[model samples]
Target: MVRVPGAKVALSTASCYPETCTTAFEMAADLGFDGVEVMVWTDPVSQDPDALRALSDRFAMPILAIHAPCLLLTQRVWTTDPWTKLQRAREAAEKLAAPTVVVHPPFRWQREYAREFVTGLARMQDESGVVFAVENMFPWRARGREVAAYLPHWDLLELDVPATTLDLSHTAVSGSDALAVCDALGDRLAHVHLADGAGSNKDEHLVPGRGSQPCAEVLERLAARGYAGCVVLEINTRRAVNRDEREADLAEGLAFARFNLAAEAAT
Candidate 1:
């Protein structure tokens, strides 16, 4: 099998949702992932750096990245203040020796935070020495009308951010060409959330190659370009009936990533 040396396939802790953060590390270790991206949400274990480090040590799984608690359900995770949440995320990443932090654009309702998000992120990156990769989000749709939910638009192309995280599922939701966006991001693409969607309004974090998105193509392209970033599996397994089912899905996703990420060896 061909292998990409620098590209590491990681599992997002959120992928184990309905399962505890601790379970994610266990599963990642059991399944042989390169590392994991911790999604810091309401889970007490997720928010504690010491606890996370302990799990990492126990599993011998390095923390690849930290996904800031920016989802609606996690608004009060670190605090009500959006900036504070990012700050804490960066601190946790630094403490864990993770190289990147994934953050979503502020919601339109968070007026003050949205207003200064671009500049604020730049400042944070400069001061913290961590890559704050702004994750792409999609516009909200309701009753056949498109609603502008995220500030400065949900499309990363419209934003003037230095670093970006290309999430394939979000690209499907936005009807964006994943490859084209990747071409545009170029060296600015710092991380990847590898999942698929079928151009649905709902973000269906389907397994790679399971939906309509070019999941395999993206992995291949990253391999061809010698990408040295984390391709994180962030699929939804909450529907899984048991740990066995979830493990099966995770295993399939990991295999898909590994197979596609490998380029033909030089003859």
Candidate 2:
């Protein structure tokens, strides 16, 4: 088995692909993340899936996954039409052949909508033969760990293996138990979104080590448990002065995160 504590650092192509996927792959390759998890928004980048695939492969990144398009304004998941975002997501996955799709649960939808959404997601996962890793959102929260506090039901919903991505910082923001969340999750975790929060409270995606979280403790827990999954660094994009600045900051920040992971392993 692969080593624990020190995982192959991963990059979310969303960090690089805000405009085009080629740039995402190129930057990821040049910057040295072990692999990439991409977001296929309805923009021009996802419009051409094959190209994205070719680029990712060319970079020789071992793992490839996609984040399903989640429209924040309307919060639509799928439909029958051509512009049907979910349909396009599946098409993009098939064409680019990503292993999984990361999904975000709607925060304030009617209970019925969440049900239909989960059912629909399950069907899509079956048909596409791709893993659907659902992420937790506050059904109602000041932050992410609140989702963990309400976790037993959501855990059942995501019992399927490899269909859950643990966003530690988000959960921390929810004032949830990081170790408890990790414990309950076990092997179902396929990915992790990393950032630091001001304690177990605020949902700020501060650069790792720049906040109050016990990063070393969390890493130690994962190391001891032998959890092998992607750790995605999610610094807020809004603060980036420009694309180039974003790229530079993200590259440096991810490198630091990975280095700490190595340090965790050694300790």
- What does candidate 2's lDDT look like per residue over 1-267, in tens digits? 323564557777666535466666677778887777776555555446766666777988744567776635324434422125566766776666666667666433334445466567667767877677777443234533243333223442344434687665666555566667767777776667776667544457666677776665666566666656667776555567777887777777686666555423343
TM-score of 1: 0.97
> Model 2, residue 61: what's the lDDT?
70
| After superposition, candidate 1 runs with Cα above 4 Å error | 1-3, 265-267
Residue-level lDDT of model 1, residues 1-267, one tens digit each, is 575749888999999998999999999999999999999988899999999999999999999999999998898888989999999999999999999999999998899999999999999989987899999999888779999999977999999999999999999999999999998999999999999999989999998888899888888888878889899999999999999999999999999988898676666
Candidate 1, which ten residues in sequence have the lowest lDDT sum? 1-10
Top model number, TM-score: 1
* Model 2 lowest lDDT segment of ten: 143-152
Q: What does the lDDT come to for candidate 2?
A: 0.62
Cα lDDT for residue 267, candidate 1: 66
User: Residue 195 of model 1: what lDDT?
Assistant: 94
Best candidate, lDDT:
1
